[model samples]
Target chain A: MLITGIKSRPVYDRLAPMASGLRHLAIAQGSGGQPMLRLLADMTPAQRGVATVVYSSESFTGNSYEAELRAVDGIDLRLCASNVEALQVLDDLLSTAKMGTRLYLAGSEGFIGTAMQRATEYGLDRDEILREHAGSFVRRVWCAHCNAYTENVTQRIFRCPGCGLDLVVRDHYSSRLAAFQGVKADGEVPGELPEIEELDT
Target chain B: MTPTAEPTAFTTDETYTPEGAYTFRNSREGVRRLPFPFPDDEYMYSMNLEPHVPAGDGAMRAAFDIDEHYISECHHRAQMLEAMPGVHYLALPHMMEAQWDLLELIFESYARDYPEHFTLTKTGNEWHWQNRLLGIDDTFTFGDPTTLPLEPMEYATRQAQGEFVVLEERDNDLVIGAGMTTQRADYSLRFNLGMRFFEFHGPVPKLHEMGILDRALKFLLRMKPGHPVRRVNWSLTVNPRLETSVETLPEWAPDRATVDAENAGERVYLRIELQPLHRLPRSNAIVFPVRTYLVSLAELVEHAPDWAKRIHRALASLDPELVDYKGFHRYHAAAVAWLAQHDDGAPLATGYPWAEGGIQPGD
Candidate 1:
C-alpha cells in the first residue's frame, strides 16, 4: 500500500581511480564492462599496472562489453561464465587480499549486492569501495516465508519459485540479504489478490 | 466538530481492566506514567530526543521499566516465539560481545531499579540471577551461550519487557546485528537484520530530504556510554495487539477493515513506543529497547480528556503519506472522524510533554 516512495535502494557511485590506493580490484558483470573499461582508461599507467579486473559474461539484458574489456592493456582481467562463479572468485580473492586494496563494482543490483556482502565480510570500509549500477533494475527478491531468493524479478507480484506461493514484492530492500522483500501476496485474505502492476524499477 | 459537552478534567478513579490477552488495563498510575507522544496539537517528524532521566514524579524512573503488565507481556512474547519458530529473533556471529553487554545491562538495570523483583550476583565468570516476578533462578557462565537455554540476547529480552535490538557500530554506521522482536508494529527482524541505520529507516517519509537521518546517524555514532538518550515514536493500531510484525501481517491486517467511526473509539489504540538508546560499555554497540504502550481512544476520552483532544488533533491533521506509512491508511478517516468529537479546537500551550493538565519539559 505504501510502496510508492522507497529510499532503501543504495545510491551507486561511478567507478573512478582512487589516487591513494596502491592496488585496485574492479569486478563487473555483463553491461558493467562499459564502466570497467572507462575506469581503466581513466586510470594512470601505474594504477592500471597493479589492478586486477574480474568480469562475468552473464547478463539479463544480453549486453556485454567483453571484447572492449579484454582489449584494455596493463590490467589483469579474469572472466567468469556466470555471476555465481564471479562471486566465488571474489570470495577466494578477498580471503587472501591485503590492506590498501580498493574495490570497484559495476553490474546489476544483484551483482553489486552480492559483491558488497563479500566486501563487508572481508571488513572493507565504505571508503575503500565504489559501486555503479548498470544494466536493468530487475530486483533480487528474498521470500519471507521460505527464506529463498529469486533473482531478476521485474513484477510487483510474482510466484515464489522456492515455496510456490504468490509473492508481492515490497518496496523495502535489505542490503544484508542483498534483495527486496517478497511476502505471500494473499496472506491477509487468501485467494484475494491485489492489482498486478510492473515494478517502477 | 462541536465543543465538548463532556467534562474537561481527568479522574484517577477509573480503572481500565484487560478484556483479552492483548488488551491492557491502565490504572490511574499507569495512565499518568504513560509517555504520551503528542506534545502539540499537530505532529511532524523531528529528532525529539531527550535524556533518559526521570521526566516527572510519576514518569519513568529508570532505563528498563517493569510494570504490572510485565508478566503478561512476557507470556505473550513466549507464545509468539513458539508459534513463529525462528522467525522472530536473529543475531550475527560478530555480535556475541554486544549480546552479553545487553544481557548484563538488562540484569543490572532491573536489579537496581526494581530490587524487590530482580537480583543479580556475580562471582568470577559465573553469575547467579533470580527473577522472582517470573519465577526463575539460574546460575551460569556469563559469556557462554551453552550455559543458557537460549542465546544471551534472547534470554535477556524474554525475561525483560519490550522488544530489544542490538545495533553494532561498523563502517561508520550502525547495523541491526541482533534482535528479539515479537512486538513490532509492522517491521521484521529477519529482513532488517544487518541493515545500516538509514537503510532500515528508508521507508520513512520526508526525513531523508531534510537530512535528519544523516544528522541523527552522526549523533548516534558519537554517543558514549552512561549518557543514554530516549524518544517517543507513535502510531495508531487497530487494537491493543502487540504482535504486529510483517511476518504475521495476515493475522492482524484484517482488523483494520473492521474499524469505523462508530467503533473507532473502542477499537483503535494509540500505540506509543518508548525507545531508549544506550551505548554499550564493552561492545561499543548501541542497544535499542522499544517499550510499547497502548491506550484505546475510549480509555483516553473517558479518563484523560486532555490527551484525547491532543491525540485527535495530531491524528486528524497527520499527513496522508504518514498515515499510510504508519499502516493506518484504511481506518485513518474513521479514526479521525471519531476523534473529532473530542477535539473542541481549543488551543494547547506551546511547550511539550503535556500531561493530563499542562505542558512540561518531559517531552
Candidate 2:
C-alpha cells in the first residue's frame, strides 16, 4: 500500500545513440555495463572514437562487466572503484564538455538519479542525456525525522537505523535527495502500523 | 491593509524595503531554471483569464514550469547583473517576507512538479530547502532571512525560470515593490520599481476600461498561496533574443528593418510570453513570473506553414492606432512579404538558433 506503483518514480530511457552529439560520454556501474555494451555496439566507429567511458565497479549484485567493457574498446575507458569517484570524473569531463556533447547513463535508481543531478548542474538538457535503470529497484530513503539517508531500501515499512523510528517509505520520491521519504510509520496511532511488505519499486 | 479598500489615486510611498550588499551577497553556484514560454502555433492575445483551480485531486500544474534552459538562463542573468549592477532587482524593506515567501512558494511548486529534482521540507520549526539543479542543500527557519546562504529574493530569482516582480498594495493601489527582471520591452526597471500598476501598464490600451487590471489585481489578492495564475502576451521580434527589455531594444531593433528574404528565417522571431502571477499569503505580494519565448519566423514557416498567412492577415487586420503602437518600422514590409511568399519550404531550411540545441518553444 505504501508504494502503489509510485507515480513519481522516474520513467527510465532505453539507451540509443542520441546522434546529435558532437562528443559522447557513456557512464555505468555494475550490471549497468550491459546497457553500455549495447550503446557502444549501436554507436558508429567514429562515434566510438569520440566517446569516453567511465565505469564504477561498485555493485550491490556483485555483477561486473569490466572485462567485456575493456575488450570492446578503441576509446578512453577509465575504471572507478566507487560511483562517487566515477561521478567526480564525470563532473570534470562535463566541466569542459562542449554544447554538442551527449551523455548516456545506466545504473541503479540512486546512481542514475544522482548522475542526473550532475548533468543538470552542468546545464545539460534532457535531450543530451539518456538514462536507463539497469539493476534492482531498491530505493534510497531519507528519514524525515533525522535527515539521514539510507541506501538500498527494499521494504515498505522498516526501522530507521538513523533515528530508531518505525519508518514507512512514502510514495513521494525526491530527485534532489535521490531518495524516497521515510517518516514515522505509526505516528498517528501508538501501536498501529502498516503491514511490512516489499515495495513495488 | 486587508486589500479591501480601493484607491482611485495614489502617491509613491516613501518607505522602501532595505537592500544592501550583505543581503544580496551571492555564491557563484547553482543552475538557472528557465521555462519554455511558447508553444508553436499562430499567436494572439486576449484577456484569456482562468482560475487557479486544480483540475484533479488538487494537483494542478502551474502556468509556468521549469525546463532544460534553467542553468544556462541563470548564467545569462548572473553575467548581466555583473555587467550592469543596478538594472535588475529592486525592492522595498517591507517586501522581505514576500521575498522569502516567494522562495518557499516556487521551491515547493518545483518539488511537487519534479519530486525527483527538488525537496522542500518542514520539520518542527526548521525548513530544509534542497535544489538538485543548483546542488544546494540548505536548512533555515521559515521566516528568518539570515539563515539563508543568499538573500531570499536573489535566491528565488536565481532559481526561478522567469524574471520576477513582486507587486504590493499600498494606499489603495498596487506598486511594484521588488523585482529581479533582466528582460523588459524597452523599460528600465530601476526607474520603474515603485511605479503604480496603472502607470506600468499605461501603454497597453483598453485594459483599464475592460476592468482587467482591477479584476486581475483582485484575483491576485484573493489567489491562494500555492496556486498560480497564468496569462499570455506576445509580439514579433527581429531575432531570438531574451534580453530585449525596452532599454536594450536599440541593439536588435535596427536589425529588423534590414531583415530581407535570405536572412528573415534566421532573424525574424515570434516573441511569446507565459506570465504567471503567484500570491504570497503572509506578505500579500503578487509575484509576477514572465517567461519569454522566441521562435524564428523561418522556423514557424517550416512547422506551421499556415501561420505565415495567418499572422500576415492578422497584421493587416490591426487598426491604424494599433499599428502605430506596435511600430513594425522598416522591416515591416519585408517581414510581411517573407511570411506571405516563404510558405513553400526550402530544402535546406533550418530552425531558430536557440530552437536547434537549447530549450525551444516546443509548445
Q: Give each model's whole-structure lDDT.
A: 0.83, 0.66
Give the TM-score comparing model 1 with the true structure, all chains together. 0.87
**Quick one: best lDDT, which candidate?**
1
When summed lDDT is taken over every stretch of 10 residues in candidate 2 chain B, the lowest stretch is B22-31
lDDT of 2 by residue, B285-335 (tens): 788877765556666555544444445555545544444445454455667
lDDT by residue for model 2 (A97-189), tens: 998999999989988878987997887877788999998888888775566788888898888888787788866565545677676666534
lDDT of 1 by residue, B82-188 (tens): 87887888899889999999999999988877676789999998999999877999999988999999889989999988899899998789989899998887777
What does chain B score (TM) in every candidate? 0.90, 0.75
Report DockQ per prediction, comma-separated. 0.50, 0.01
TM-score of each: 0.87, 0.51
Please give the lDDT score for candidate 1. Answer: 0.83
Off by over 4 Å in 1: A19-23, A43-51, A73-76, A163-168, A184-197, B1-29, B57-59, B144-146, B342-363
Which 10 residues in a row give candidate 1 chain B its minimum summed lDDT?
B1-10
